[model samples]
Target: MPRARNTGSRSPARGAGPGRAGTPGRGQGTPAGRGQGTPAGRGQGAPADRGQGARGRGPIAGPSNDGQQQQARAPRRRRFRPGTRALMEIRKFQKSTKLLLRKLPFARVVREVCQDVGGVDFRWQAYAIMALQEAAEAFLVGLMEDANLIALHAKRVTIMPKDVQLARRIRGPEKGFASL
Candidate 1:
């Protein structure tokens, strides 16, 4: 428990009749309702009663001196560390090539064969996998183009296996590319 505040002695007027002056009671000084308070310009006035509304201290809401509506602030830009742009570009390239590889029929087969190589600790990246797939596809395409030419030269529309063998032979064995 705490001790009550000792206001010294009580004045006679403070405990006087209800209608007496300088006393709080049913008198002319009592406020009526919501619209009643101390007169204006004495202290901080109520927002509803002020001439400038509630935005007295803030920037006025209207067009500027240039006769244009206030422009909204632009969104913040992304900041990257120094030398990280190359890393970001490499990741982007990997992602794009990975997406392209998804559309190729031999992508899965090539990835699996490289991963399943025996007695080797070969690790495959997206670039390496894509490189191998592209080289193989190019070799096949060139060989087929040559075989098609050979067939055309032979007065035939269909290419036989011998045409492909001849094409490979013409490419020579020293190139390390074996026959189909």
Candidate 2:
């Protein structure tokens, strides 16, 4: 008979099983550490892994690639509604009128009205102040009416006549009479 072919001995290849060795296989046929070694150190170092981890943070953290693409394509936003815009124009008019009245010397107007209107030597300053207050009230009431008209027609049109008049009265010649 032929020799027993070492049937009773355990082979060294069998001892290289995964659990028995500390290092796993490297590439296809090279030894464990010969080429790129363990999976952890093969590509970039550990610091690169940490840097990737840090990037995935904050409120929008971990949005897939597609989500970021969609956000970039979104549109811009508008700041004001038609009704609010009308009111803003009226307010600008009111402010400018008040500024012009302030620059004029109302004391002279008061002195003249008192001297000319009443012979009893009444206070003209008080009358001038009252006139200014009445003018402001009239302007405010007109603005309110214009605002109402703008609101009533807001859904159907872009401009209202009452609003235009108010703008003209307040802005005078400075604003080139821009209509609402």
lDDT of 2 by residue, 37-143 (tens): 22233443333222232222323244575887868887867789658988888789767645334424555665576778876555545656767756755665666
Q: What does the lDDT read for residue 146 in candidate 1?
A: 94
Misplaced by over 4 Å in model 2 are 1-127, 130-134, 154-180
Residues 85-124, candidate 1, lDDT per residue (tens digit)? 9779867865763433443556667656766876455656
What are the TM-scores, per candidate, against the unseen true structure?
0.37, 0.23
lDDT score, candidate 1, position 2: 62
Best by lDDT: 1
Error of 1 at 138 (Å): 1.5
lDDT scores in order:
0.59, 0.51
For model 2 the TM-score comes to 0.23
* Runs of candidate 1 exceeding 4 Å displacement: 1-105, 115-121
